[model samples]
Target chain A: MMIRLHRSPSSSMARLIGQPDLCSVSNWTSRENQLHNRSSRATEQLVALCKWLEMRMTKLIAGTTISLDGFTADAKGSPAALYADFAELQQSEAMQHAYRTTGAVIMGRRSFDMAEDPDSYAEDYEFRTPLIIVTAKPPAKHPKEGNGVSIIFATSGVADAVRQAKQAAGDRDVTCVGGGMLIQSLLRESLVDELQIDIAPVILGSGLRLFENVDQRKLKLTSATSLAGGRTSLVYEPL
Target chain B: MMIRLHRSPSSSMARLIGQPDLCSVSNWTSRENQLHNRSSRATEQLVALCKWLEMRMTKLIAGTTISLDGFTADAKGSPAALYADFAELQQSEAMQHAYRTTGAVIMGRRSFDMAEDPDSYAEDYEFRTPLIIVTAKPPAKHPKEGNGVSIIFATSGVADAVRQAKQAAGDRDVTCVGGGMLIQSLLRESLVDELQIDIAPVILGSGLRLFENVDQRKLKLTSATSLAGGRTSLVYEPL
Candidate 1:
């Protein structure tokens, strides 16, 4: 039996528009992030229509490393250790498969600004596929020429950004790559299908909580694997 | 090398005084929940002195089953299935030994009120040993004469409550039985030496968070064991 997933009108998912092969991926340049010809109202309507037409079973998975005290990032917006122990996960065959199969990445604007430009790293980032950033404003920095990454800014809302990301992901899973308000909204509106939490053995004391103001949700534990260095990854699907 | 154990003066730990062996295991009676001759002030001062003399090394271990969303109990004051999945843990020889060796149990007042009295169960409760409760107000109901468990109320504060609980525990480990405001204070003061968190698959979206207002502390993961009911227990010692 084929499963058909229809757009959950419950979530006003935004319409995702890829920022045209923006700046040539070579020299660092600054371009004012602005919407050129897209009409806001028309885009929202188009996104709704596209969502109605695109009835595919793509899962929007939210993944993040949260502290034992339940913090993903600090108040100042710096993530707790960023990718410190994440490297250990790279050695896991299952983790490697996840990275290879992840079709696209969606993050909040804060994550985009905090993350180093993929071009500067020399090596392509694992999330270099396609990046959709959800923010009211665009970052001052632009991708350099030659970087194998595409950027899309969703000014509309989370629902729009998620819809755009799911459509872009096709049948593969779309990973929500940030914490804070973005994921909070995702939890609030139930736009996410799966949650993969990497529990780090530290308490940031007082930072942003991963789950706040969200209703109780009973999740089914599909998998749990312990990573070296006191970190464990837990995968869950809504029951 | 033999290490010296000492009660922490910094915490102003309380003195544990057991109620007279009341009733020979069969009957109902009503007594005002007041410490007849014990004055709060005298108890505090005596606690300080006893801890100074006792100087015995007793570890206070906090254990609670937390949901994916970090709630240990619901808003209605009921525990997340009060040790429902804990039965699997009973199979572990080490766990059984620990339960047998445990000298006392400490819990917040709410947990005490919410739990079924051991007497009502018509059998010995797993935590049939000495029980210490920390609450601002005394519970209205007292154990019917036949219940074998003993009770001590710590009204002064958490520091005093834990001190009393530790002293009663003797050389054995004292289990801080629930996750609530009392444990939060213990975490704040860095009083807990070891934390054993059982991660339950259920996510209670809006009840009570297990940890709140806690400062950042790095914890060393000592052990991780999976339970049969899809629950995983992670043990950590504060670094």
Candidate 2:
């Protein structure tokens, strides 16, 4: 028999498992509630199945533009040189795919702070999704939230931040925007599902490298495309 | 009136400028020698013109396979991981072009030493051309060279080695087959004309980076191609 899920199975499973309300599943019908109460053993089995499906559906992708030499930013944490081809990179097919698939973003505090005005992201950012900022402490005042964008401060750790972001993402992807340190931590923990690297045609002799201190991993190239303005987009997944 | 050069103008120009016999220009016709003896002033002008043409024609290309994270070799100076896509990389159009156009090679001593047997290069290496090894001192014994391959030890330093390689290359390109240190030195001196990087799908985490300690330079992407076995070939020239 075919089972029709009115809401995302994972969301319903989370509610039945007594997890925090990570997603909105409040519109459950009386029939579904009756079914949930019918068999505890069957519900547990369904929870395991949904959890497996959720793990497969929600991906965490680390996406960033780096220099030819693999640096994400210059010594002073500026990515000015690396973004010369930003306009073209933004128009690339891979980037468009990232934008369409991303439902949440996780970034380090430094990356968030690098923005001249965090409030601008509410309306101007490409991914108008929930933004989870990982930091040791949340700031005193939060940015004004609107346009379906919410700023969340995760002080627990990167792992917790990833969990929250994945929940917010639902079936979509959680993209890790960077300051190098954040991406490195995620890579070290093997939390990243895919790496979308746009290699700019500039060499920064000394800078903040993207892969510094990350665990060694063998990656299989998924796609390589030449973008406009001499930018190459390379997609890889850990093997 | 059109002036045709029977021999390479640079060869004739080098002789006119009283430089070392860098190339074999002995096949100069008597008429050409009479022209070389005819006017010192005209010969001086031709030397300057040929020098400009030579500078424009002969390019120095630094080519190597690097990991996605920019490491040319692992900590032990082994590129085993990087060469996983070598068979396809060698068949790539860019690599084929490199092979077709390269007439001489310059390498560091460490790279030379890495070869189990130096004499095997004559039979096994792709480029059956002159090999110039840059070192502080030449070895007491020389490898048995044949099959149009001659090994020269350049105790005079990298710059002098480059000069010798370029002279030997004649109208073709001089390629630097490296260990990272040699490529870095060439980059520091702004001598590399093109960077032919074959990015393999791997992250070394810690290793010898290809662009380490080099001068910061802006490059324009010439071409980016995806090769067999998930390898990416990117060609760049300094802007």
Specify the highest-TM-score model's number.
2
Candidate 2 lDDT by residue in tens digits, B10-83 = 75656667543354558989897676556556656777777656645678889888999998888877889988
lDDT of 1: 0.70
The C-alpha stretches of model 1 lying farther than 4 A from their native spots are A1-57, A81-95, A116-124, A137-142, A145-147, B1-57, B80-98, B116-124, B135-148, B155-160
- Residue B21, model 1: lDDT of 41
Q: What does the lDDT read for residue B51 in candidate 1?
A: 55
TM-score of each: 0.70, 0.82
Look at candidate 2 and tell me the lDDT of residue A139: 82
What's the C-alpha lDDT at position B154 in model 1?
Answer: 84
Chain B alone, candidate 1, TM-score of 0.69
Docking class of 1: acceptable
List the lowest-lDDT window of 10 residues for candidate 1 chain A.
A10-19
Q: Which predicted model would earn the best DockQ? A: 2
